[model samples]
Target: MALSKFLGLFLIHIALLSSSCFAADPFVFYDFEVSYITASPLGVPQQVIAINNKFPGPTINSTTNNNVVINVRNKLDESLLLHWSGIQQRRSSWQDGLPGTNCPIPPKWNWTYQFQVKDQIGSFFYFPSLHFQRAAGGFGGFIINNRDIIPIPFGSPDGDITILIGDWYTRNHTALRKALDAGKDLGMPDGVLINGKGPYQYNDTLVPDGIDYETIDVHPGKTYRLRVHNVGISTSLNFRIQSHNLLLAETEGSYTVQQNYTSLDIHVGQSYSFLLTTDQNASSDYYIVASARFVNESQWKRVTGVAILRYSNSKGKAAGPLPDPPQDEYDKTFSMNQARSIRWNVSASGARPNPQGSFRYGSINVTEIFVLKNKPPVTIDGKRRTTLSGISFVNPATPIRLADQFKVKGVYKLDFPSRPLTGPPKMETSVINGTFRGFMEVILQNNDTKVQTYHLSGYAFFVVGMDYGEWSENSRGTYNKWDGIARSTTQVYPGAWTAILISLDNVGVWNLRTENLDSWYLGQETYIRVVNPEVTNKTELPMPDNVLYCGALSKRQKYAKKSRFYVNGYLRKMAVKTNNG
Candidate 1:
């Protein structure tokens, strides 16, 4: 009997240990400090805001469903908020770093962000979301690896590479914000950058000396997974490798049909994964170039950010001559054709591809439709603002999510229009509310003459269709009813409209705004509230205990009386007093 009992206890101990090993999840912690550092991207010295004194901040590598905790200490004079781009903070929207949903950490204060990267696997990034701070740096990549249970669609590459492409400005971020605040338009960029360095040429012959170029090293006859992200504040970039082909694999978190292309157009707030084989001549290096595309046709020139793809065995003092890329930056036909070719890979492993809640969106019933039309700039309350559907959004005196949770009144309105209004632009708060678990569609119509890119927080959407002119009932026939790709950010061409379908599976306040920093800062944005249903916790979650309140909410909380109150058998008086007083 003694021996039997000892054996039983040993088995139980072994079982517990096995379970713990299988269920272990990593917790990533980062200490981020926002400060100024001198760097030269265009060979001209300038002060840029950096995190931990490193420009293009540190990359946070994590696995799916892992918890990420970042302690941010603000050292700048301005308020700072960091947004995890393309991260669907599922059932944890309070962790999303948006000004309308969370309070910023003031100078010298520390704020901690704790959330799980649930059910997501892809190449994403993080950047500052306030006061045009992104242009001055403090951005980094957030890469999430897939779970062991899931199989990747493509073959495993020998290595992985990340390239961040963007346009650079010589002026300080504050000066640019001041110019925009004064209603002056920010013209073209001084130069473009690839991984924070590039060549800048003033006039035709005056080129900056001692320019550092970003270099990529690879072995001959080896394949690599290249994760490319367009993190620019403005302008669309076309990435290409001279004399080489690219096999596209994924976008954001969705597996896409592998297609071959020589060049790819990546708009702001977008990311893509491609398989690049270093099958070229190993004796010589090649040029990898990224240039501005779809800008003003008359002003289109050879403004490009270049890097060298050097072989590991090659020895060379110079990388020979630069290879030529397509000079037609204004080719609308080519651009649109490339955009239409991106489709979800139905045959990929673990891909649902169903008619509802999957790649094929045929049987999915869109419960609501939001028609957002972009109008020209207009002066409102002595400031030039960009209007979305005739309303230029104004920040409330408190965070919308906090106000909703505490039942604060007059913080925002729930009756935002579903269609654009005709007439003069007006300064107003635009917010649309939807029932939890309701599938919705948003149609973005660009009425102006420039390309527009928009990003949605807390969720990724299926890009169903895009077409020229205004969207109407007749436009439904042109929609990509099947095989629409899922992405967090998408672009709408000039005089065209883009349609995206999303499910309100996450209950919280979300922001839908332009990726263009100028337009976003000038009020081309709005919020959406997902109301929780009483039955299920799948779409709704409990409020985090450590959330910070600011603005008017802070004042009310400070002056409110705290007394004993009980309704649900727990102490609810603190929340009641702060919300009601």
Candidate 2:
């Protein structure tokens, strides 16, 4: 009887081994199924394409610069494509997975992608690019260059952790795309998700429909990496390792000067990674907390899911309850001001051929009526004729160019003032003509006494500064604070390109330079006087340079009906203490 029972147990073990998940080996061709998963909370299967029901699909580990072949099969009805947004391709540009760059794989079709895994030795991501599928429920996963060594803040068990931040909408992706394709204005996201799960489904039991509500487990005396990416178009999130401070390791896959914080602010189209170490020899249970950056006006805002990090008893004690996230963590003042400013413009113009390729129009093509009767076909002006309302053109790639005769020193400041954060200004028609006639005022002041060449990072621009009008935050009285920053006279140029640059020590030296272009023109110089700032007398690092900026103004005065050009660029990079700032 004992022999028989032992044999039966051995047989069961064999069966379980056959069904257990095995780590995928390198260079092995793999196939995955993308489908809906019937979750317990809603009793409805979520439409997720999964490798073995894993929403993140699978973690891929490979050596430096290893080439991998992935055979992706679209099990769903929609056409699917894959994009590596972060990975810089070596030579094969066609593998970029852009819609028109190459063809998208049709539904039920299989496509083989060949690319070399970069050896940069950092954490990366891989996801799906289906017809509106990524926004919905199609793909997720991370890629690692296991260089026989791992990142810092390590321990034995539960030593490292990676959190993938993303958002999800319950509405069908196809349906949503249809609305977007139809030109309907789709608003914000309904929910923020972390790793394809939400708190209500992961840890909240009060919600009767919760699914797989397992708290995240973490051990004390261990370190982990929280890899974050905001894949959703709508919701922005601030995530924190509950009760534990985090050290930022990298931003956008590039290492930054290490800084510690209890939480991180993640914006749309941004990714960040954090390294966190827990107290060794402490009680284990830990939570990864997530919250929306802002609560919508509507009641019952969505809460992102939670995870538990369980540690061994010998590891340590449970940390105190998670602290409240900092209220101003998501403030634009903090995130926007801290970064070096890189600026460019968005244009609504026609495409023109250049040395390399066609300068693009708008991202998409949309039409509108314009009343520019005197405008020349090739220039912003036709025999100095004025415009009423002009054509409304839309495309993502509209090429904005620098003016034929002017050089922008650089972008200084973009002030929206406390009031009128949204909406067009009065005298709209006058502003349009004023700006078109080079009457828009753009002020640049050099606070630094030492000379430094400042380069505006993105999009080319024409230099124009002319007096147009006075701009004040309050209508009750005029303030001198807005004087130099708010110029009455300015230069009017098209709005396709946004950012400009300036020399640090030179009071009013406007430099003419174009990046990504090799030609220089003799007529491209503008003479504008620089006004000194009255607010402060000292010139030091990080002091307000006192340069105010206004764009897309038809006239230097204010927003008007005729100021029709699109202003799309945001400032991104600013270099200090460099010869070519």
Candidate 3:
């Protein structure tokens, strides 16, 4: 079968002139109804969340600078929030989708999110943020195309395809959450799925009926751009195509220097685009493989997910043995070396006219330095919890953004530490106070046994450096300041440290957390709270008109909300002039 298609981009252009017309960028909108449905992605029947009755939600096809408005109607019994994984909610934090920053849409209620894709291009994704919902369903590809004026660095491919590969569990999300709540560990996944499908003939002997795998129909001697996203909840995946090399092109909306490899390590919450040329024999199909990386094979079943790459005129299926994966080495140096090889194509234009590295990040002085650390989960007061810098994140009873906007005190503390603390972990609603427009250096120290992937919302930071052993002042000497690829999510291997340089130009409270869903739920997360003392309409948008005020602010405040307006297809923020309820 052909690749599951994306929602067609409807360009609603209005001509300004009669003869030689000028058309503005159009707004892309979708009314999404999130509800539950019975599906068997793992060959076991379970209820999964669906958007508009589609299991994997809907792929969003949009362009840079285009305003995207999604009206999400929640029909699940539990609350729901959807985060645009790599989309920087620049100047508009009200729609960031973190439960602490924005309120969740209650059951049977709906909320509309409006934000500009602004100066971004390439692969990304959106998924449900509340609870372990993502383990069951609710994820889709988000592609931002470059405008006509911008030039693509590589030759145009025959077509673009998106693949969502991840580990799967037979237990439903609710059962998984209950297990975690009871201080239990979720063992290995039952299977791995590609594009919301189970393995080929995985349960044919065990069960009479089972879900099948994905098949990508391709033409001989033609090339295609495949955008891959590791939407898995936990496991880190290494993806490969049999008898083919994956030409790395762009990652998480940034163009990278072209490099070819047989296998690629994709951590949870990561996205990439690779150019695959169909150069092999056309008589038989090929296997598309995604296997769990850093997983022990002796004690547990090998997590191998497979799909098919078929030629249009093919006669039979694949017959050869699967490609050999890299040996499971305790010291994962080969993957690290491969990651280090990916660099930014500094000369290529992204969504804007300027080159990728037009801003000389090395020349800029860092205003602040932070050394955050993570440790393995420990049983605290009869519950397993993960800590970031000695603090277990506690979600506040109200939205922190609404509290900060109304100057409500005591909603959250801004005393989050810049370094790990000395004693046992503590739970608090805490955040890091970041100076607006400050170029900062952040080092994430991973002392945990497993590889950790961290994701920063509202901004894509530069991965400057990473190394085994502990990080120190001397580690700065090994930094890659010249051409660090900019991306939202990065992996720091076990017992390793990764440093990033981020300029806090966006104003708002943003989530900085590990991508592991269990850890995030158990509190391996924090927020960077950036305050612009001289906030303006140009610098920040006003509070969303539909914001559900709670906590301290709900006690007294009510106001005629000054909202935004879509002026001729562009989003324009209105000034706040009233405050009283």
Give the worst 10-residue stretch by lDDT in candidate 1.
563-572
Question: What shift in Å separates residue 28 of candidate 3 from its native position after superposition?
Answer: 0.6
Q: Which consecutive 10 residues in model 2 have the weakest lDDT in total?
A: 567-576
Identify the runs in model 2 with alpha carbons over 4 angstroms from their true place: 1-30, 40-44, 146-158, 182-188, 200-209, 280-284, 294-300, 314-322, 329-331, 337-581
Task: Report RMSD (Å) for each prediction in the order shown.
Answer: 8.2, 21.3, 7.5
State model 1's lDDT: 0.79
1 or 3, which is superior by lDDT? 3
Ranking by TM-score: 3, 1, 2
- Assess every candidate by TM-score: 0.88, 0.51, 0.90
Off by over 4 Å in 3: 1-24, 202-209, 299-302, 328-331, 352-358, 553-581
Q: List model 1 lDDT by residue over 1-581, tens digit each.
A: 49996577556533432322223565555667888899988878998888988887888888877767676778998888899998988766687898889877778766666677777788898999988999998898888877778799877799988888888888989999999999999888887888888743322343456787788989989999999988887788889887789899988878899999999989988999999998877666677878787765345453578787888887653344445555655555677768889998867764231224444466778889889999778887788999899899988868898887788888888877898887777887669887677888899999977788999998888898898878998899988877888889999988999999987777789999999889999999998898775745555555544456687678643332131011111112222332355
Please state the error at residue 565 of candidate 2 in Å: 49
Writing each residue's lDDT as its tens digit, candidate 3 over 215-315 gives 99999999899999999888999899989999999998789999999999999999999999999887788889888888786543446787889999888
* lDDT tens digits, residue span 88-186, model 2: 332333344533223455566545554444433334555564455666544454444444454432322244445666545566566666655454434
For residue 56, model 2's alpha carbon misses the true position, in angstroms, by 2.7
